[model samples]
Target: WSEPRVWPLPNVWLGVSTENQKWADVRIPILLDTPAAVRFISAEPLLGPIDLWNVNGINAIEPDWIGGPTAGTGCPHP
Candidate 1:
C-alpha cells in the first residue's frame, strides 16, 4: 500500500495497534512514506502508550491527527 495514495482526498488516515507484531503497527512506516498531504493516527485499542523503546518508528509516521485509544476494559465493579 506504499504506492502513493490514489485517493481523491489529500488526507490520509491510519490505525496503529501498540501491541507488538501487529500488522498495523508494522505497516505504519510504509503508509507514512506514501507522501500524503496529511496523515493521522488512530490509537484506539492502543494497548497503552507504547514504550519509547519502540516509538521511533511512530514518530516517522508524523500523524496530522490523533484519536484516543478505545478502552479495552469493561464496566468496573462487579
Candidate 2:
C-alpha cells in the first residue's frame, strides 16, 4: 500500500493538466485516502476551479501550481 505524506513535506500533489479536472478530482482522494500524515492537492494546470465531495487526508489545497495545455506531458510529442 502507498504511504501517506509526512509532515514537513506536502503530500498528494497531482498534475491538473495530466488529463482533466476529472483526473485531479478522482486521483486526489486516492492519494489522501493513503495512510499519509499530511495530504494536499497541487491543483496544477488550473484550467478552472474545482470542488470535491470529500477530502479524507487532505490538509491543504494549493492554488494553481501547474498549468498549460500540455503541462505534465512526460515524453513529449515523440
Please, what is the TM-score per model?
0.37, 0.48
Q: How well is each residue in 1-78 modelled by candidate 1, as lDDT tens digits?
A: 678856635554443443323645576676566555454444434344333244332433321223445444321222
Please tell me which predicted candidate would have the highest lDDT against the true structure.
Answer: 2
Minimum summed lDDT over a 10-residue window in model 1 is located at 57-66
TM-score result, candidate 1: 0.37
Kindly provide the TM-score of model 2 when superposed on the true structure, using C-alpha atoms.
Answer: 0.48
